[model samples]
Structures are given as structure tokens and as C-alpha cells.
Target: MQLQAYTFADTTEIKDLVTRTFSDSEGVDEGKLIGNLAFELLTETPEKDVFCFIAKENNAIIGCIIFSRLIFVRDIQVFILAPVAIATEFQRQGIGQKLIRFGLQTLKLNGIELALTYGDPNYYCKVGFQPISEQHIPAPLKLTYPHGWLAQSLTNNPIPKINEKPKCVRALAKPEYW
Candidate 1:
């Protein structure tokens, strides 16, 4: 298996991977929603605000992850991880976790200070994510599952408290996604 940054040529495969994975795991509607979300995040978001990574096996995309900038009133550098997916057949093989680790490491190397994600805490915890309250760092939108709000400091320092609410990229600004 190989993990690397995604290129424009990988767009269709990435969207299909996410759509099919979510369809098999969640359902058809959810698959379409997240698949469309992934497509927009990859194609519409500004290059400086988006990062995409993929895991491939035998030259086929098997897993993918995306991180987009979260702008705050303050100057701190932060990004949000969302819409991660692993091919149905590849689930439970640690490919998702490996991709996440690689993505986070890449962010850290680029001097990103914090990483946030909203998802299953149990699964995210495996990758060093911890529950964080809006009081410490307010989310761009009201969270549907507050318990799933997670964050980690890439610099090894504690997650800092920021009173200002952050705004996510246009691709992730939909309240339905929160």
C-alpha cells in the first residue's frame, strides 16, 4: 500500500471511493451527501485551505481523507478533518487510521498548530483526538453531536482556549454537515 498526496487526476476515484464506502456503511442518501461533499471540498476549496491524502493498494485508491482550514477571529492556524472514507472491502484494516496519521503529520510539518474533527469519538480517539468543548474553541456552526467535537494540538502543547468562533471553508459551511 502507498500513501500520498492526491492530484487532480485522482478526483473521480476519490469521490467514488467515498460515495461507495458511505453507501455501504451508512446508506444511499448519506453516500451521495458525503460523496458530493468530498467532491466540492476537493474541487471548490482554495488550494491554500484544503489538503487531501489518499491510500492506494495495487494502484487503486482504497482510502482518502480531507482537511480544510478553519479561520478564527484570532490568528491561530487551525484545520478541520472531515469526510474520511475507506473502501468497503478495506474497512477494519487500519488504512483509515494510517491515512489520518499521515495527513496529521503532514499538517504538523507544515506548521499547523491544531487539528479538529467531528466524528465517532471512539474511532477518532485511536488517532489521538480528545473531546473539546465549544467554550475552549467554538465551532463554525452548532454541532449536532457535541460529544463528537474533537481536537489535538500538533505542537504537543495543550489545546488552547479561543473565545472567537471559527469559520470553516465554503465547502463545509453547511449546517447539515455539523
Candidate 2:
């Protein structure tokens, strides 16, 4: 399998992969929601505010992940990882984790300081994410599952404590997403 940066041609396949993977694990409705979310994050969001990555095997997209910039008043570079999905047939083979790691490494190489994500802490923990309180680094919106807020320093230093609430990219600004 090869990890690749997303291109316009990958849009349809990426959406289908996210939709089908979530439909298999979650319900069809949830699959649709995330699939739409991924599409918006790609097509609607500004290029400067988003990064998309994919895992492919023989030119077929098997998994995908997205990271959107989080703007804060203070000068700091941060991004949020979200809506990760791996094709149903490819799940449990570490493809998702590998894709995530590749995405994070790219972000780090580009000088990103902090990386945050909201999801299953147990799964995220394996990739260096730790439970982070909103008080430490406020999310764009009130979190429905506060405990799921996780973060890790992409740089060598620790994540700084910032009370200023950060704003997520337009595609991820919806209340339902927080």
C-alpha cells in the first residue's frame, strides 16, 4: 500500500470509501453524514485550511484522513484530525493507523505545532494522542463528548495552554461536528 496526497481525481473514490466504511461500522445515516462532511472539507474549505491524505493499493483508495486548520488569536499553528475512514475490507489491518501517522508526519514536517482530534481516545492513543481538556485548548464549539477531545504536540515542546477559543475551518464549523 502507498500513502499519497489527495488530488482532485480522488474525490469520488474518497467519498465512497468514507461512506461505505462508516456504513459498515456505524449506520447508513452516520456514514452519509461523515461522507458529506469529508466532501465539504475537501471541496468547500479553502485549500490553505485543509489537508487531505489517502492510502492506496494498486491505485485504489483504501483509506483516507483529513486535517483542517484551527485558527486562534494567538500565533500558533494547530490542526484538527477528523472523519477518518478505511474501507470495510481493509479495516483491522493497521491501514488507518498507518495513514494517520503519515498525515501527522507530513504536518510535522510542514512545521505544525499541535494536532488535535475528537474521537475514540483508545484508538487515538495508539497514535500519540492523549486526552486533553477543553480548558487547556478550547475547541471551536462545545464538545458533545468532552472526553474525546485529544491532542498531541507535533513539535518537541509540550502543547501550550491557551484559553482563547480556536475557530475551526468553515467546513468543520457546524455545531454537530463538535
Those runs of model 2 whose alpha carbons end farther than 4 Å from true positions after fitting are none
The alpha-carbon root-mean-square deviation between model 1 and the true structure, to one decimal in Å, is: 0.7
**lDDT per residue as tens, model 2, 1-178:** 9998899788888889999988899899989989999998999888878889999998899999999999998899999999899888888999988999999999999889999999999999999999999889888898999999999999889988998998888878888777
User: How much does each candidate deviate from the true structure in C-alpha RMSD?
Assistant: 0.7, 0.8
Give the whole-model CA lDDT for all candidates, comma-separated.
Answer: 0.95, 0.92
Task: Please give each candidate's TM-score.
Answer: 0.98, 0.98
Which candidate ranks first by lDDT, i.e. highest? Answer: 1
Question: Candidate 1 — worst ten consecutive residues by lDDT sum?
Answer: 71-80
